[model samples]
Target: MNRATVSSSLPSSPSRRSFLGLGLGAGAALALAACGSSKGASGGTGTGSSVLKWGWALPTSWDPVFSSAGWDVHTLSLVYAGLTKLDPHGAAVPALASAWKYNADGTRVTFTLRPGLKFSDGAALDATAVKKSLDRGRTDPKSLVAPQLTSVKAVSAPDPTTVVIDLTHADYQLPNLLAGKTGMVVNPAAFTTNAAGLASKPAGSGPFTLTSYTQNAKAVLRRNPTYWDAAAIKLSGVEVYPLPDASTVVAALQSGQYNVAQIPGSQVEAAKAAGLEVQVIPSMVVATLDVNSSKAPFDNPKVVEALKYAIDREALLKTQAFGHGEVSYQPFPKGYAGYDPNSANLFPYDPDKAKELLAQAGHAGGLDVTLTTAVAQGEPEQIQAQLKKVGINAKIEVIPQAQFTQIIYIQHDRQVAVDQFAGRDSAVQAFQVLFGEEGLMNPGRTTPPELTAAVDKVTRTPLDSPDYPTVLQAATATAVRSTPNVFLYTVPRILARTKSVSALPEFTVVQRFEGVSVG
Candidate 1:
């Protein structure tokens, strides 16, 4: 099995106590025909609300590979399909690939693609296409999605329906990794049309085909009649509209301009009073504060520990999160297999201890730093207020979503950055993104040998092996001890829709239109 390793030293102070105080937390309509008129020219399904006007508080962009915006994934999921899909609960399940078998060494994986699958453009989905897609990701150095593929040794087509992938290291959680939005497959022919064709107009073998799109405005998708899983599709078309303001999203939902929209925790009661169906699920999304260890003050382990101790997660959670989330101590949230109960209780709220550690690091009075974040569902203003009490002066700067990737992921200059991680199908998914050598989430900027080794052990070990639990525990321990980043809370995803829709899945926050229906 191929394995990737990471290493880092433990900080001088013990891990802080777990944060517990934070407060947490699709459809259609039809037109009516004249009474007993037997339906004239407008007969078919009463037009059936052909377009699903979805209102989200984020901008729309066709470039899925370059944009980290969650809205991009929502659009891409409609236009493209991956080899494997993540279930509602964030577990990896087969999608385009009918079945898969891992070699005993775990370094190699062979997938039996479903035969007769073809792109909307009528091109067959064979091993060559898969290879081409993988190759593009590997070769594009500027691509954020490419680093996920450490190395693809070979991509061979044993037959029209089989694609064998040879990896440089054993990645037991490879399937989950592929399920990420970044690993979406694109049509090889379309990709070659222009060097950057896929970025603007993605082509894939999904239930819906992108018919039209307007950047930062709206996108339209039409049903793919040639879609292999057409029978499972319900809606004829979907229209996604970007509504970035929280108040605007609430107003739209109430006005019936949108069938579905994200409701902030503060508005849950008001939505319920208006007779809308409100559903809340544990979101895999987490918000955290990243300390820049590569720069001054924070370069010292003591300063990092002091900072962690000073911020009261409970107060932040209660005030900013509206009591809708759980305090997170590590990258892996509760309900995940790798979550460490012991580590969750390790850190306690202690301002005195935090001050002592700061003094030990040579900053007895306090320090001045700039905190950066993008406006989202959380309470950034309130979180900052709590940080000020600990002797640190934190200035908040909000940036646009398009510039977020460059500011946080690439530049990595902020003193403390508030960021989020999308839920993944497996623990390894969290491990790779937060601790992998080139992981985008490692804001502390430390890549120690010990941290790398621990993460490697967890990724390489088979999920069913006896030692799997041990490896997970060790990795979590390593993360807490090193304090690469502070894990805050798992925010709940609140979605509101009309009662006309049914059969919604339970696990993922993203809607799967297959089983959904209009009354």
Candidate 2:
């Protein structure tokens, strides 16, 4: 990249004082104060008047891997360019690499770099840079998603414009893999020295450059005059504020402090009532009740099935999501690939069946289990209430979001935990996330032999091959029928933005800043 000195300071959370220093200027300050009072203010008149003020819960992190954090992915989309971009429908589209072709055997893929492309720091974005970025990702210990490149034997830069990637196996989903957010191209020089250096100050060929970042408080993104697609750029700058409180975020959006902010399920109506443009996008996220199969009261298949039967997903969705979510029966959310609509539903809210199953498993009067959940999501409270109705003594243990990964995904100490994991667009990606040998969502603790076999067959076969669909179906069926997780609902990402903002494309996560304009 820029060959700048890498900072060793770990990314500190942004403080409120740092938020004010990010410089929203006089106009932005006024807008922030007046936004709540003036429901639908007219667009500003100045040529450079468009400075979009956005808000979210957390500050941007340094992780380049997509699977690491959702905040990182959202920030990378604004500052870094990926080899291939995923369209709204999760289809691949060209980004830094103009076009690419795969060999008939699907073992080799060649990409042609867009001529004259340069990083924000004026570093040339050539084949060598691409190779370096990919190589670093392949070797990075923090990169869980990049290791999936086990099939990628080597990456080469035969010419300045031509980059070739050789695969160990014929992977038909190579293009889809490239479309992942972690696949963002980096400046090799910047990335190689102190790989975590880019986390605080990222250098890429994106439309915006990181001007300043203060953890939890605010982040300032300045327009890149040297951006390859500068002509398409509309905003002069963007100020992102991290407001964890849903009420605060909604108030900021109404008060004009934020041009766009996440609106909680309960506050969607409030924003709409204030004349704010509310966008509800169908998210590929599942709010599921996971059973820790490694522990007692759940190790027995009948007990797990009993818990699944006891849950009333429709009621939970209505109460917890405020009737904004759709019921989900499998790991794959609706509209995702390999999601079979006709599969037999595992649990149909039959309390009597749940009782029978519990008794059959030698627990006639119900079982006592600790249910752990992240408090902010509202699923845990609702689930605990439901379980109580079925005579299960459930206690709710709330953990902070920052600690959830370690507590649930890594530790596996709890008997039951609720998963708010976002579903992957590709069936293979979804499968890997839920049932892969080292998947985070494998609450079953023990990966069943049948599930492992099915996943292996699908992973080895080409996605386009006729056997691919059958294998995927079998794997999904095995997962669903096994009842490792009780799939509940798909929650929509509700966002409130200014009416002047256009081209706010719907994303799997509600807050994508790309192509968004204020005025």
Candidate 3:
């Protein structure tokens, strides 16, 4: 958010020599080396002792409004403070806005800003800035979060600190919804000059300011001294490197390249053996098979139903996730409010029934289709073998991880792909992104009428009502019975960090860095 940091040029896919030539510093070079290395990094402490080197995926876009990936919400959270933030229990708490109250009918909500909040640009980040961001999120054609704010009729700032949001109907999901990407406020001055430039140059009131960034390599951030919650942020700086490879995670953490890093379930023991503290924290993420309903094999309802019964969720739990996952039948996890007990075994593994359904659908000889995925993991191969048992011959097509989002979410060309959905903060928003007409994961862009009506009941019901959870479960049942997405298993986020680092809380959504410190 500092002008000096913002003015720094962000180079794309530069060679090692060219990267250092940019003069970003030794930290940038260490991040690149760590990112590209399979073996341990050239040690001797990559960065300052006060700086936390984190190994994680780089955000697809820096701007929350234009970001296509759901996980980007966490990375952007470092630079942009939202109106509300979620506690460890996933409940909404105040951040920029001190407090908020809804009207009697729940059709309007008023938020009171904390006194004297300022953006990195030294501009007033008051009610007017919040209104502008909310308006843009709802009205901007390019905003990926627009679907979550369709019910917002208008956003108004009556005074310097009072912001009001008028909704078309009674909706109680706003607080939690705002806690995520939709609630993050951007500097109006920066966006007005060049909206697209905000993707690389961010200006927010979050705890950290981007000092330097190189695409697919690393992002170096320095502490924002002016952050409203400065006392909570302990790290002087943070160096983030994109290390998506699970195999390299243990080595990276053990070699002092990354003090904390996300590892696969299989690597948990390895991390523990290396004297690193491990936390296998439960998450709302569900690995599912995204089926294009408008496509060839899936157009037939019977074919879609057949594939649902074809998969063995238990086998996938053991094989694909190495028993670090729970077999799931719906989008919401088992303990979540939206999970439906009745729908747990709606389409249990029954190859005979699957074959019968295929025969009835005039595909008795079987049908050939593609199982596309970005990662070359055992899950897709396992799914391919299982589908073959029910006469569904699946050819696996591996696409580059960089192009996966473009092909599946943007271009909508995938027939059936393996995707892990990092569920949203609100169940209503999660449903919209999974089964709604404009959902990013729904490549076919099709949703059943039953699902739409069911989710509507969830939004209208107040969160305080006892019937709220029931309506949510009903919607889950509808989605489970009607949608083509095959729920496989729920896996926890496995993180390995040094014993010196502490205070990593268990968050239901993406990982949070607030209060995390390296002692």
Candidate 4:
């Protein structure tokens, strides 16, 4: 069977449309879409072969429904095309679906799929396939996306190319929400035949197909000729290897074993000195101190406020991130629509103020607390030292990184801990995960009524509406003022690659290789 036959004559995508008009669309829809190793770079095919050898962590699971790690969203995207993809600006654009529109009041959204699309296995990727994938996302007991799809009342397929999503309330954020794992469509037949096997084998109509995979080690992919916009794909294939150790990245790149890798901020100078092209891309990652407000000490609002003021964000940025990031006051990055400028100095570093607040909270003699962490090297130690000056003694407790979330997030057995937040696809989604009552980061499972109201307003506003930014910023302010978390800094994703590599873009802070080339 010839793979090219699936989309031998599909036309180019339609033009950009506003959220109020034909719906959310961007330039050349379905366009643009990493990681890691010490393996031979370029697969011995030379630079012109367009094969990317990347040093990055591999996904925990290929199937989006079963993948528990939010960080895996970008890696999984290489094999599964979501209904909507994000633009460089993090706006929702077309990918699998050519165009989409919402009805009056925004309760329902209709997506029109590109015609004659096929999975790598030659299965039709039509509206029915989308319905099946979305239904499973909300109904499957093992699905990690069920929580994100609660607003989705039902999904209906009216025709081969048409899919209508019925929402429980006005939700203009669905397009952005679908730009991540929740929107990735999988081959129904593959999961039906062997659901458990999907952890290794993925069947999707994406830009690439899984040619070979080794769990936690390596994954090789070949470009799918049947992809809707195959002509836009410049790379013949992509090879990824898990290179978690930051110290090894520069050596791997300089040794010609890896052409592209996510190096740590500390390695930035080393990579540049080695003549490697380094891209310090602004990211949504926030290194934060999560305070469980339900627990003693923090249960008192003054205590939480004191902890906030005690954090020296500038010092943390220089020490932990090596001055490669900005001091952050909220979950959203600066210049993003959801970021609030007024909150930039919300909690100025004031040890005296923190001490006064502590006394006001009835801890006049100083307080003792536990600072749990998965990695106890850089920031955790700095944080512990800073708090001591403000009369807060923090005992460092280390836990395995793998079990940190389960213990702190799920089990709610933590008082305060250092954690990294990988931002979500949508601003609203980020707020829900960071501040919602049941948000994974909210160990205490509490949400202030004002914060909830502000976030809800963001959902009701259209993505293209002039009022959207204000609504999102309003929500950010609410969360900043009431949330029980101290955001320390925003770390940029430092990508070290050979000069030959170019066009590597990031959407929603996830590195994309689509339209990228090696030579």
Candidate 5:
């Protein structure tokens, strides 16, 4: 990692100032002006023509360990490289490390560094660097990845190229998370505790180096000449602009002020009409209507069971997600290990059954509650309508994304929240997040006895052992029947890029920026 002093300033380049003046002046003369000439496919014919103009939201913090501000992990991926990376098929592929192997018990894993690999600053990317990066991820108090590595005992380097990750217990999900933002390696020499010092210049081994960045505004990156995979490198530079508004992003894509951007699903058609390409991938995210199990009107088992029977998962998918999402009744999605289809479809929509259960629970007339959500796009109204049919009155409460955790968890003011979380490769990851001892929605922050024992058994059962599948299925089924959360659906990942971009691969977690070309 380059630990040298960073340049405080840089020369100016082209600007799209008019795009900033967008306002909803329907009756005034504040209409947006015409867009400027397009940057041709052939690197604009010169002058950093190979620069890929990419625009998206900027992360709140520049610190890699604590910068998990929504989907901003994609931005960090461009500046820092991980040990393992996900392929289009969700399989682990080598990045900084060439090859890796695991022990028979799945308690220890070893990785071999790719020879001749160097950071942007000409620093060695050997086993020592790998150990430091993994240690930071596992031990950093503020690190988001630390929770995922709770089972990891230590990260060590035996030789120059050999790196080892020792686990206290078996974990199949650790490697995949290491291949993602959780595993993004930062050069220790270039790193600073201060956010600005680190953001001023990120000395990573990625395809590009951060030249300049303004919080929530723009970032300019120059190519890293020492990139290991030359064939994957296409753009000489990558410029990122953060326009928070969805309407604004769509407008920029339509007018050609920006080459590639991620737009909402509703705006997919608009982008396609403007001659841009679109790809809708199924993201590993699941939404749920969380209930305060320890609170009144919900503490009763009948109430929880009734809430499960009341929701119309399929209808919610079609009405809210533009029919691009799939129904998710369990914590983990289908095709993942420990997933049980029988559990996923356990609760069907039966308004009569829901009413009967409520009556039996001593709430025959109805119960009034609040459904808090960050999304205001008719989701609240739709849910309000659905619950009303089951004799429950649901009021909508709109909260900002940042304030949701504080209000729901700390303050305990939000009785019910329509929230979502990322699903991992192993079903245990999802189960632990929603029902484990320290889970978000678990009552009193304590795991249910049945769920706890089931998860424990799964961890003890080796992956290759015949009992592994049986124990995993039991855990998933128990959690599903418990109904700690009313599993709803997983939203589709929708992105819009210019037609000039020849290759854009699908993403299971975060969007990938590698192997992209302007021509």
Candidate 6:
């Protein structure tokens, strides 16, 4: 979900920018596939108008709970209001719910909604609606946001203005979790029809309403003047283009056809040189080579251990990041609270050790292993060359990230893959999704139950407890030892907008357009 929410298993597409950047795939393929032409398009690119044209990749779905693509959240959030919103720093902030209070032990939590809030469809957004949305997400097995609320026993409304959530375990981070897509309020009217039926017809209480939405096409949103928090939004309308290629997004920004653009870091200087305003937004993404433990070669712990010393993370980060990132030696980034400062030293760059381990594991000359990545993302040739040095023949296979998701996550047929494990506002969110049980959208290879249980124990540990950091760091190392994922590097998040555009505030992940205004 890398909003980071959602898994790679969603109905496919792409997000997390820089896809079609320097040395990457061409953008015309994505641009041509989209509804070609028309700055005249209704998203308000009209002459001398008070409208904001936001350009980025399309969404998986409009259903707030069902939506997983990260880029979609930026625009969709403008149309749907969560109980609370996660700030750029990942802190929970007031939104639809003005204030909240928790019981002494944290088992029971109550939220107080801002007065007189109404959905885009004219339905009152009361405590009952909050309960409906939460219960639906908690019960839906496929809901990406459900795992965070696994401890919730019931969602009840004690009164019209107050909603109470009863948790079986004491969860201090429930407020932060609720501030995500799962806790986003949705109208029961649209949901009553069918789950998939709410794809394009999402009913919400935000600054905008969905006038139109087409898969792989542009989404048109009109201003909701009646919105409770609509004072700062001066735009008459907003049009979001789901352009896949990074080049296309840059082109849109440069051409003055798009007011706001989510540009890749590779093109920051280029976009800036083109006179586009670049917002250097810091983001988190852990590039890793996951060795499917369920399969051969990787099944041997020594062979998996050998990989830790094989690749040069610093060199890889330099090549991939263009000097914009640092090596990610642990499962979680250093910015994460529980990150072990010593994990980077766990496996230093030692090709000799890597070779010896491989030979000891009975792969003397190294066995042939396949590495899969998106067409533009995985410099498969570079990796293929690097693996050759260690006598490990790594064959490269490149495909679209969307197809990559379908194969690795949905089909679960991948043997070894070079994947990007996105950073989450909550550190446990990424761990639970990537390494937990298969049911929680563990897109990576299945780990042993012991690993899962140990990781789950960390999630249950109170964040404030003294043992919290120890448990958190231990679980990460334990999982890494399982050889499911080889820590790679972290990349920066970037965004670009026209100079004329106003109020484009930055967030770690684009959660919402709180005070965005367009000239």
- Backbone clash count for every predicted candidate, in the order shown: 33, 13, 0, 8, 1, 4
Instruction: List TM-scores for all candidates, in order.
Output: 0.85, 0.85, 0.88, 0.90, 0.83, 0.83
Off by over 4 Å in 1: 1-50, 57-64, 375-378, 423-426
| Candidate 6 residue-wise lDDT, 413-509, digit = tens | 6667776655554556656666765522344446677777766676565544566668877777776666357777776556687878764665654
Q: Is candidate 4 or candidate 6 better by TM-score?
A: 4
Ranking of all candidate structures by their TM-score, best first: 4, 3, 1, 2, 6, 5
lDDT of 2 by residue, 1-519 (tens): 111111112121100000100111122111111111111221122125477887764333444652355434555667777676655645455667777776766678788777888887788888989888887778777765675677889999999988899988766565556655547777877766756656566767777766766655777776665565666666777777765477676677767888888777788888888888888887666777767788898889988888888898888888777888788777655554456666646578898888888889998877789988766446777777777777789888887766776777678788888766565535566666676656676655577788777766665665445565567777788878864677888777777887887747775532455556687
What are the runs in model 4 whose C-alpha is more than 4 Å off? Answer: 1-48, 506-508
Provide the overall lDDT of each model, using Cα atoms, as 2-decimal numbers.
Answer: 0.65, 0.66, 0.78, 0.79, 0.67, 0.66
- Sort the candidates on lDDT, descending order: 4, 3, 5, 2, 6, 1
Where does candidate 3 have its weakest 10-residue lDDT segment? 14-23
Q: 420-445, model 4: which lDDT tens digit per residue?
A: 78788888888878888888889989
Best by lDDT: 4
* lDDT preference between candidates 4 and 5, better one: 4
Q: What are the per-residue Cα lDDT tens digits for candidate 3 across 354-433?
A: 99999999999999999998768688999999999999999999987667767876688778998887688788888888
Off by over 4 Å in 5: 1-48, 192-196, 199-201, 425-427, 440-444, 457-474
Candidate 3 Cα lDDT to native: 0.78
RMSDs, each prediction? 8.5, 9.4, 9.4, 8.4, 9.7, 7.5
Output the lDDT of residue 334, model 6. 60
lDDT of 6: 0.66
Model 6, residue 34: C-alpha shift (Å): 22
